[model samples]
Target: MDTIISIIVPIYNAEKFLASCIDSILSQTFKNFELLLIDDGSQDSSLSICQKYQQNDNRITVFHKNNEGVTAARKYGVEKAKGEYISFVDADDIIPENSLALLYKEHDNADMVIGNFIEVMPHYSKKNKLYSPQVGRFNGIDYISLQLENKLYHAPWGKIIRKNCFNDDIFTTPRDIFRGEDLIMNIKLGLNIKDIKIVNTIVYYYMIRPSSCMQSRKPTLEYEKMFDRFLMLILKRNKLDTKLKKSILSQRIDALTGLLTEKIHLDKNDTFVKMIYSQLKISSFDMRQILLKTCLSHPSIFNILYRVYRKLSSITT
Candidate 1:
């Protein structure tokens, strides 16, 4: 029998948390789901553990491919998925037992369903527990607005998308330039589809291990440049409304400012530095015009730079 949902999990060197991750899925209250474990060429015992699970459960399908990135692994799993709805789970993260059940129940008349998540550190530490401050229903067409307005985060694990959402024009695309690929993909998905549902339930447990890519202290500039590429892609699309356009550009400016600082600290002359600088020139002024939008969306950046930039731009303008 075909499953209702396909839980796509891309695994690398996740030996430490592999069992917990798999066990979480196995313990899901929704029984009509299959776990697609794609082993992205792990040099550790992760592949063996995946094989063990495959042996234990017929619903678990294991795919062993050469060391490809998460994007590739997910694409591979989607290609083989036989479920109506598709959900993603990181190899190190766990989900609530009734998470899938709730998401599926709330998936009525919507293209995608998004849920809440908690940040789980390696050990129970006060520093690792950061709950997102923004939460609500999103009725805007702007993908970046949803992002800027705190309607959604660039997390694939917290959302369940229809299988059709990963069709050829989307999932099979050759674009991999963005570090926040999930953001770009979700943006495209949001634009293409109209209905999106938000379920107010904390479903996923995000593991904040030291070696996690997003948590890495010394992340490379390429990852930072992904923000720039995402903005450029949105601008070139040229189909969004005025509000969305301004919001997207404003959000891009804010994101680039942070990326530039990170680059300045990490590498003085990374290849993307010049391009980002040029973008800043154009967006810096527009950011001032859309000052209210930026001020409300990203208060921290606005508080520090608002006075300084307002004074400097006033002199220049």
Candidate 2:
């Protein structure tokens, strides 16, 4: 009862699992928490369900706003949250009964508490825990490096954060970042976090709904926006050394390569990506950027591959 945790569930057409998600929170072993259900222009009965739950539970607060995607909904909830600590839960996912209690136990010493989650698929479930290198509390530049280098879990769920860790300026320049919003939010949040604890216990049930899958992204103007937005965050952020910068470059290249696996598109984003290659410093390219663990950094090599890949795939229009 000393420091109540605020749990925010951003809802957008998640009516099917909304009830169960709410029930899981209501049945938490730790009761000293506030539940904020933010309905982001959901077309289904998600808002109604939230209203019904709020009618019965005094701690439940329901808010409705225009559909501005998950990041905006999350930002709205954070603005309204009154607790010292905050946690996010996708309305389609569920949290364990002791999840709040587990995260709460570490609040006094850590700026954030991140727990492993089990990915519940149709046939099986897999637990996600920390590896040896990611087993301890991290702070300052180390925290940023771990997060940017993909050393820590990027999802906002399964993590309890000190409310003050959120930097509002990151949200000032609104941009639609596809499905990478969670990682982007976490990247921004990491800058302000002084201490973060990674726990071994399972805390969330990330239900892998079969219908939740979407098509792979093309390197279109939209993709450019997402990448540029992330790059802006990196360049604008202060205190980043050579090591951290390389980590971010590696991560971005990995993502770009992953996208190219599905399909390569000739869009305006390509020009922007070329700039990224120049920034990496070709003179420092050790055996095709093997040092950075990136696929292709040279503009000519990347262009040749992209052109060949495009022609081979026969992608017109």
What TM-score, over all chains together, does every model reach? 0.76, 0.79
- Lowest summed lDDT window (length 10), candidate 2: 291-300
Task: Tell me the TM-score of model 1.
Answer: 0.76
Question: Number of clashing pairs, model 1?
Answer: 0
- Candidate 2 to truth, TM: 0.79
Provide the lDDT at 284 for model 2: 73
Off by over 4 Å in 1: 127-144, 148-150, 172-178, 213-230, 241-243, 260-317
The lDDT per prediction is 0.71, 0.73
Best by lDDT: 2
All models, RMSD in angstroms: 7.0, 6.8
Off by over 4 Å in 2: 1-3, 123-133, 216-233, 241-243, 265-317
lDDT tens digits by residue: candidate 1, 1-317: 77889999999999999999999999999999999999999999999999998998999999999996888898889989999889999998999999999899888767778888888776545555544524444543744567653346777787788887676545433454534566666666665666677766888999877677454344445655665555556646756645565565455545545543453342324555443333344354455535434433444565466667768865754
What's the C-alpha lDDT at position 113 in model 1? 83
Pairs with steric clashes in candidate 1: none
Write the residue-wise lDDT of candidate 2 on 1-317 in tens digits.
55478999999999889999999999999999999999999999999999999999999999999998888898899999998889999998999899999888866669888888877775445543223236677775676677666767677888788888776864544464565566666667777788888777788988877556655544554565466566555656564645576777656655655545545542324665665555565467433244222434332355456555458534421
